[model samples]
Target: MAERDTTGAEGAGTEAPPDRKRMRSAARLGAVQALYQMEMTGATLKGAEVEFESRWLGAEIEGEQYHAADVKFFRRLLRAAVDRQAEIDQLTDAALVERWPLGRIDPTLRALFRAAGAELLALPTPPKVAINEFVEVAKAFFDAGKEARFVNGVLDHVARAAKPAAFPA
Candidate 1:
């Protein structure tokens, strides 16, 4: 797994346990995967949330163990993404280059944007923190550094727009 922490405690020298940091990161990634599954399978929010919460949050599969996620944060992300999808999509579209509308992007990327957008829009989490968390999530899903950079750029745009004061002039 990636060595980065999404809980903003990296390099802090014991501000929080590594396991706690990893859990939040896992929540962000889980939210993205749940969102993608919902889109691809037309799963209802409740159904998908239940499935992820009960079966996948910390389950082992194929000899690989998934970290336990912050269940509340995961639910918040999933609900916000679905509850505010239209706005999220619009924000994502505005952030992307004109040639690459939100719909035209990879489905995984679209899910990533929506999850990040939800935090940027509705959560009190710092915009930069949210961006960094989701960028790391992108890295987990993709092998190439290119996708991570793309995630960072788009999320920066969304963050600036969603919380302008957080980014000072």
Candidate 2:
């Protein structure tokens, strides 16, 4: 894993923006992009992992200094999502209408869905929160109404079918 540049200067005397939520959303968006690149290029898992770190660093430097905890949390979330991808894809496919294979979906959307669904099913976070976060990410990069709604609906189905135990009470 690439080390975060902890030596970087902190924003002196400046209160952090209230945009941490958006930044976190953007990080997950970045992870989806990395996953899409990996799938399209047929890169190995290690290659994809390295690419994620590199891209994340670039994003951080271009953006602001994200809290280390948030950065670390996203990295863990992305890895867990990648690790359980096959199972997550299987579950997602099963939930789809007419057995839509992941490859048949738009690659970007597929990656986003897989990443989101993997977190929903495998991570210890609440399902509704995961779905909402990913929906926000999708909205940032795509048409919010139709595409975002599609993502939300499919992921909701996956959450119910794949890992009902993780669903919100």
Candidate 3:
């Protein structure tokens, strides 16, 4: 349950980007933040999903298209992650060193890892693609080199441990 202030005025709208890739990137980042909020507050997945949609997708962000497809995709992804969090956490814990249990990691990083890991394990996409997308999301919110490297490394480790068959050759 992240606090919602809605204090700032909405920016003027710009031309929508024709590229779906950019839209997907924005959706993924939205999903990550929603997952992080749910993790921090112990909110139900549905509650978090609605909050994210109302705040990010519902808000009139300049130059962005909050397509229904993107909202649905993000909601599905976040719900899946929350529903299967225990299994995902177990996989993540096994991939990490004993001292670095997921609970001990920064909450934001832990949530990001769980969300990415859940997608990698449960989604139909190739594991490498999921990892790459999540790494890009990490880079946007964190230091590009260090955070992306960390996300990539941990995800690689988790993929190897939990879904070796899905790992790229």
Candidate 4:
């Protein structure tokens, strides 16, 4: 989600309040990116978290501006993904078909799953909302609809397992 900087040249315009939904969506995107950075670069949780917060969040990169993220929500998602990593990975593995395990998946997809799994396990977000949000994330990274559909199916299974009460018999 790209939100342009709204301030005028002299910073005289009245900037609108941040949209809560967009901020949270940006947070999800940031968390996934941070996790992917950690996985690829061997960055520590604190290091990755700080780097994303300071350098990436709301920063224009490659000429595209990013939306301001919900910092607290971003931190929570990143921490949950790192802290409960083994558990999240286990849940993801269980959700995937036998031929494709968690480790064998694309790194970006893996990161997205970890962030989404953490939210499913630790946050109060409704499972469907989490699923939809992450499906959108998958769409952001993948050009084809196939990857988005794959993310949707896997996250759906993970959500059902993580929050059974949300999906009653």
Judging by lDDT against the true structure, name the best candidate: 4
Better of 1 and 3 by lDDT: 1
Report the Cα lDDT for candidate 1: 0.87
TM-score of each: 0.89, 0.72, 0.77, 0.89
Model 1 weakest 10-residue run by lDDT: 7-16
lDDT of 3 at 92: 82
lDDT (tens digit, per residue) of candidate 1 on 85-132: 999999889988899898899999999999999988977777877888
Global lDDT scores for all candidate models: 0.87, 0.69, 0.71, 0.88
In model 3, state the lDDT of residue 22. 57
Give me the runs in candidate 1 sitting further than 4 Å from their true place: 1-17
Q: Which residue runs of candidate 4 sit more than 4 Å off their true CA positions?
A: 1-18
lDDT-sorted candidate list, best first: 4, 1, 3, 2
The true-versus-predicted C-alpha distance at residue 120 of model 4, in Å, is: 0.2
lDDT of 2 by residue, 72-128 (tens): 545655676788888888877876677567778888888888788766765554567
**Span of ten consecutive residues with least summed lDDT in model 3:** 5-14
